[model samples]
Target: MFKKPIQKYTGKIGEVEIGTGEKAVKLGGESVLPFYSFDGNTGNTPKIGMEISDVYPEGWTNTLKELYKDVSNDTVKWAQFVEKKYSPDFICLRLVSADPNGKDSSPEDCAEKVKAVVEAIKTPLLVAGTGNHEKDAKLFEKIAQAAEGHNVLLMSAVEDNYKTVAAAGVLAYNNKVVAESSVDINLAKQINILINQLGIGNENVVDNVGCSAGGYGYEYVISTLDRVKLAALTQNDKTLQIPIISPVSSETWKSKESVEPEEEAPEWGNQEDRGISMEVAAAAGVLASGSNAIILRHPKSVEVMRSFISELLG
Candidate 1:
């Protein structure tokens, strides 16, 4: 029997570094298709980030509700608990409460929470805005300043909002910027171009390949990410080559398979486990597809994902 020869990616576009003031991170080194254990090298493996919020989130599933319980209500304490107990490599802080109808925390208010959380942990941070473009810009502008020199990775700078947020991250924090686009390869590229045009170097930008849940367009999202990696490696497209970022928690949150009651979907098994498992599954899909950093919810889910990554790397 003839053993099949394995293909190795050339050079190392994924190996480029993202500057963080004095320090930098090597983005590439993946020799495999995401997490194909039986395939080439996934040198960096995957990183799991625990998600917290400056204000309590509404409409969370009972599974999350029960696990986090009271701690979910307090962002500062929540981050500390995750950092001290769970020991995740990163902590993702969502500024959801800054919404006008939500906690309505101003940019200043958001910055303080960021500062408090930053002081609470040594693990790197992923600070995300509430998704309201304008407010997110304002919130992250302050957040960038507060988190400056800490080398944190800012959650996002989308096509429409890239100018303000990207500028803030580059000028204020010297933090890494996540360039997000809906699940379109062209859009992903365009945003990357836009960020670079803003005088923010590629060394500071990460591609946020759009995300989806297990049952909701997962295949499409997966393929899109796959294209990104191929473009980066094969096409020599630098825009898609930067470390991929995905908010796996937010993406999986909407899946019925992740949030519906067990009784409503008995084939899924226990409700809590089903939710956590779906979150893990969605995350695994992205990891398999090609994501460098993922923001996740639930300590249990993060634990399982981290274990899976260990097995892949080991």
Candidate 2:
């Protein structure tokens, strides 16, 4: 009789639990390649988060606005609505208006939004900054202080700001940190190492090893994901074994393919459908590649990915 080869790993993706109690969402803890359950443990099933902004988003398409019209005006209301209606595993609040280059909002206001959203829902909450290294470090500090004891997941502690973010957010307030890096295995591993050097445990880290979901470089993302997963499982790379989470919606929606008007690209077909398709496709690609979780903007995209994940993991 012919039998299949069963390969197992010495290391497992460190599991991270967000929020608390029964409603908490767990990610990672896989002992084998994603979905290779026949060989070893798949750990916790991948999670999906619905992404909303701290303020009403300005450039969102009409399709998305219409779907979230009732609650999009208020950040807390938006999260509550999604949690109740769609039942996502978590909610991601992008501090869009906090950018000093843009709205120049204060960290205090942003933290208030975080407190409001966290209070409004039982599901876990994740917060992302405006990518300003200095501002984000301060913003994360305030958010950590305000949300202390609630234990939210801060979107990132990048190479430039890992020290500040890790210190204030993780050490001071007991929140988790997302160690983000560009889509390269070495960079990914390095960031994890740096964050770990600060005494942050594997269980407290999630990796955002970049995403090419918006445009043309999916192969890079796939390769990075594959290498990171292989190292974690086969080579027992502890730093690389952390779970991955990518923000797919913001990436896809900002791309020209999704933003172009029909009149400008008459041959491209309907605009909204194109955007949704792109979002779903990009998210599915990353999930298959090895993302432990993905946050999406559109409800339709979330609905589709939920079913896709269920079908695949089933």
Candidate 3:
């Protein structure tokens, strides 16, 4: 009985190599479905990214607030702490206070913060926003300029507002940019198309397939990531081949499965344990599905995931 050999696609964004080693982590180049070595090569294992914030998150689970409390209020300290303590390969910095209806920090304020963190660290940084479309447009523009030539990897330029952010990343900083769209494959393709049209080099872009916590909707995210890999290897679509990102830590915080205390949901175990489980499950699922990078919180979760990845690669 002869089974067909798995097909392999070598994906690239302009000149950027997809996956690990010379690239961030090997993710987009697989001939078969995930883990089906008989189908193709799973040359690169997943990589973990630590998530840090510019300001304190008002309602982060008490468990996390306490462990990271010492450095949580200061972005430079937090980033340095994670890099030194965890040895994370990448860092995700979220500019949350810049939300117009939130902390309302101005573009200049955001730029200063980014510059400070950039000055303090050497690992690649993923600059994300507070998810407010309009505010992020202005905020990322200034921040991108301040990070010019640092080769920073900007968190995102999504649909409806890719123009400004993509332009700044392409023209000013000459750095990498993440293009996020919903779980929809078409929308994901479109955003990647638009980014290239803006003259942003392909090698300088990654794609975020939208973060999903455990309990509900995780399947959709995982499936979409699988589709992107399929498109890259089978369809050989360049737009879909860019590295996929998972903001696993932030998305997990909002899930009821991770938040309800044991007294409230005794069968689920302690709230902290459930939360940590959710984080691990989410990381495992995303890693298996083909995400090259993950943004995570909680030192324990970071340790567990790193160990898991180490075992898988072994």
Candidate 4:
């Protein structure tokens, strides 16, 4: 008889609950590599958060745009549509309109939009800002205040700028913050520690150690995330023990494999199908490497990944 090798982990990813009432979602707390229930507790299945922007998506391919044509004009309507149509585990509202170089939308405007979305949808919300550090700080403060008591997952608090957003999300609003870092594991750990030092418990923090799509440095992301998970499970590193969030949709769509049209490259097959495949491939990689929650864009990609997750868990 042959013996099966079994491994044990000292640390487990912590669980953090978002939203309130029946539609609430819980992420993380997995004791094994995503769906590996035979070795340890799976805790909860990973959650998929559909990404919807506060502003109409600009520069999105026509295929991506058409998917939300009905509600693209309005942020609240878009959130409601995704929840009603797909019933995603959560909804991520990216406040792109707040970008200083873009719409430069006021904090009050962003706050109002956040409030409207929360009221319009039953799903838990993950609110994110444009990648502008200073602008995000201001945006998060208002978003946190507007979403007070809602327990939305605030998108980020980075190494260069975390105080304002961390305070807004953790201290002021009692919400959670996503501690983001580049592909560097040390930077990822450092940011988490910095956020925790601000009195935000590790339980209230999730890590986003950067995400890359297929054919776009995807392997680097996978390895970095795997390292983080290893440190958490094997070394019992507290700073890296929090659940991870990968915004795969954003990176996937940016890849040439996703955006290049068939006319541009006939060998790529249908652009839409290629894009979906790219997103699915990137998402699968992220999940396998230990992502507790993922933000996805296309509806078809979401459906496919959901089914894939079902099969994996089963």
Candidate 5:
């Protein structure tokens, strides 16, 4: 009988700590590919973060609306609900109100909301700005200041708008920053390098490879993630070895297969199940591709993915 060969690598993913004292959560520090414990050490199991929005999720699907209906009107209450009910590893606060096209809320207001949520949650928090680059720079600066010393993860400093967020990470607080790049490994590396150049240590950086839902170029994201991980471990690429985070909920729920009702696509079967499955599939793909943390929505999806991670790590 032939024995399977075990592969070892020269580099390990850097570990990042969020929160402080007893509430802290440590992610990354894995020495091998996801779930490849037979080959090398899998230093930490992936962590799940539940998403909460600064503004009411008015445009969310009915299912999502129902899930948070009781607390939808209040961001602090919503964060508390997720922490108490689901016990997620962290709470991700999406500052949708800061969107330039949307409420365009003032930086001070957004910062106050961030501070309130930070004070309300015991688990670590991940704060994200609305997708407006120019506005996010100002938004994150205020948020980073409000969340100082709390050790939150402030996402993200992209290729074009890194200086502002990176400076906030260094000057405002010791929080980590997410470096996002379109689905290209080299671009991902470049952004990480640029973020580090701003004096943010590699350990304080997380990579986001521009996530895509299952049917919408998800495979491309997965392949890019795989290549990045390969570069980190196989070739010992320091610039590529930081932890990766996937905003699975945001990507999956936006897909037509997830949000479209069964009435629109009868062949898709139950709409609720379809949406949950879509999230689970996307999350599992990212986890297997070496993501250390995932931002998720839907309690059912969180439950299912938690079980899946347990099985993989076991």
Candidate 6:
């Protein structure tokens, strides 16, 4: 007798909701691999976030600079502009000014800007700080306090400062935190364990297993994502079962192939097209590999990723 084999899983990525009211977005909750609807469930259709920074966005290519030219000077305006024009699944604000090595902007001031951005839009917001552990810990605490009732998503809580970030973001206030680790599966599982030990449930925790642009040592990123998702779906590892969000824009934009000038890299073709292609390709690669959500920079890249997701969902 020929019987179609249907695979069943004992574990599922927990679903966590960000923001409140009508526009709140949910990620995670897949009991199967990426788009493996035939086997079990592919859970949500994944998510795409438009990335905006607190700074003036200098050194950006002309297309992006012009897109937000009027709003580039103000973070609030930048948030509003993207929301009005594109309406991404969510808006992720990069608190670059808070880097101790950079402008070293005060946490208080950054929180004020965050509050204003929250007030200006109905869509949910994800607040991220400079990658420095010490600096980001302080920045996450302040922003978490400012966006308390809104229940926004904080960029991350690394091993160095998970206590500070998880305490303030999840305990003191009603928000979620990203357990970010370098591209290591063991580290990813360990960090999630440490965070859960803080008394935070899986529903309030997401994982950032790390990622890179497609050709730039990206094999590491893809492999880590695969291991984590497979463990969650097939092996049912609770610690690694949380949703994973990859910041594709942050990794792709800085690559030479995406940003080098036409005069310098004429063989590569148009710069904007080149960048968008890079962003879309990198994003598609991660999504296929098992990322629950992604962060994209250029609006065109966001549009392309969204269309690809739509086509896949259909």
lDDT of each: 0.77, 0.88, 0.78, 0.89, 0.88, 0.89
Cα RMSDs of all predictions? 2.8, 1.2, 3.1, 1.1, 1.2, 1.4
Give lDDT tens digits, candidate 6, residues 126-150: 9888899998888888989999899
Clashes of 2: 0
lDDT of 4 by residue, 159-244 (tens): 66799999988898898899999987999999988888888888899889999975547778899989999898888898898989
Task: Write the number of the candidate with greater TM-score, choosing between 1 and 4.
Answer: 4
- Give the alpha carbon lDDT tens digit for every residue of 191-293 in model 3: 9999889877566787898878854588889888888877876676877767777889998977998878778888887888888888888988988887777
Error of 4 at 6 (Å): 2.3
Which parts of model 5 have CA positions greater than 4 angstroms off? Answer: none
RMSD of 2: 1.2
Query: How well does each candidate superpose onto the true structure, as a TM-score?
Result: 0.89, 0.97, 0.90, 0.97, 0.97, 0.97
lDDT score, candidate 3: 0.78
Overall local distance difference test of candidate 1: 0.77
| Collision count for each candidate, in order | 2, 0, 7, 0, 0, 0
10 residues in a row with least lDDT, candidate 3 = 14-23
Q: What are the per-residue Cα lDDT tens digits for candidate 2 across 1-314?
A: 98998885788888998887578989998898878878878889889998898777877987788888888888888888889888889889999999998898999999988988888788999999998888999899999988887779998899899999988888989989899999999999999999989988988989999887554477788888999999998899987989999888878888888989999998999999899899999989888878999989877898899889888777
**Residue lDDT tens for model 1, 1-314:** 98877666652335434423322345546755666545666656566778887766667887677767778888888887887888876788888878877778889988998888886667777888877888888878888899887777777888778888989887666877888888889998899888888887776887887888765478889989888888776667766667787888987776777777877778878877777877898888888778887788878888888888887766
Strongest candidate by lDDT: 6
Q: Write model 5 residue lDDT over 55-108, tens digit each, in one string.
A: 789867888899999998999999999999999999999988888888889999
Q: 239 in model 3: Cα distance from truth in Å?
A: 2.0
Least accurate 10 contiguous residues by lDDT in model 6: 57-66
Q: What is the lDDT of residue 293 in candidate 5?
A: 91
* Backbone clashes in model 2, listed as residue pairs: none
